[model samples]
Target: MICLNSLGKRIAYLRKRSNLTQRQLMNILDFENLSRYENDERKPNIDIIVKLSKHFKISTDWILTGQEHKSYRNFQHKIELDDNEKNFIKLFDQLTEFEKGQIIGRMEQLIEMH
Candidate 1:
């Protein structure tokens, strides 16, 4: 029986839950090493781990270990956002209250102009 402790199992589980095929994930990751990772033939390096974690919006700790984190557990429906959209949201969220208001005001102005 495969246990959650196995990195391969965790990855495979996530991939399936996300409703993605190995080929789809491979295309998205742009890496051919996924097969090895899923097979437990090899472990991903820190950089690869970080990339996967960010891509999946999951904690590295949870990925490396079997522990279910609240963040991962409460994961909502999959919403695919490209890098630009993700970056924009991240930057926007980091803005101060006044800054955010200013940005929203600008956005509203732009929308009105359209």
Candidate 2:
């Protein structure tokens, strides 16, 4: 039987790789007070699992049952997001609100120019 504790660990691991904090991930999953689940203090049910899988864009089966050959859950194969593709996320995190708006305006102008 797959342990709920282990499942929580996998969830936390993938969430971190996605560059999301527990609070941020919980917001997307619409689960309040989700820290306990990530910390393995509480178990998440099937409904939560479904939401989590969808939010992370991964297979529920893959998340629950890790690959037989690997020690980790290998979500990279399940969800591919290259650095170049998600660079805007890094910039958005680093930039201030005003700076973000300026960058958006610049991008819009560049797009219009093309």
lDDT (CA) for every model shown?
0.81, 0.74
Scored by lDDT, the top model is 1
Clashes of each: 0, 0
> lDDT per residue, candidate 1, 39-95, as tens digits?
999998876676677779887888899776676555634567899998999998677
Candidate 2: which stretches are off by over 4 Å?
Answer: 1-5, 68-114
Question: Given candidate 2, what's the lDDT at residue 16?
Answer: 82
The local lDDT score (0 to 100) that residue 8 gets in candidate 2 is: 67
Query: Could you give me the TM-score of model 1 versus the true structure?
Result: 0.56
TM-score of candidate 2 on Cα atoms, chains taken together = 0.51
Off by over 4 Å in 1: 68-114
Residue-level lDDT tens digits of model 2 in 1-114:
534347667888788889998888888878865778777788788778777776777767766764343433565557677898689677675775578779899999999999
- For each candidate, give its TM-score against the true structure: 0.56, 0.51
RMSD of each: 10.5, 10.2
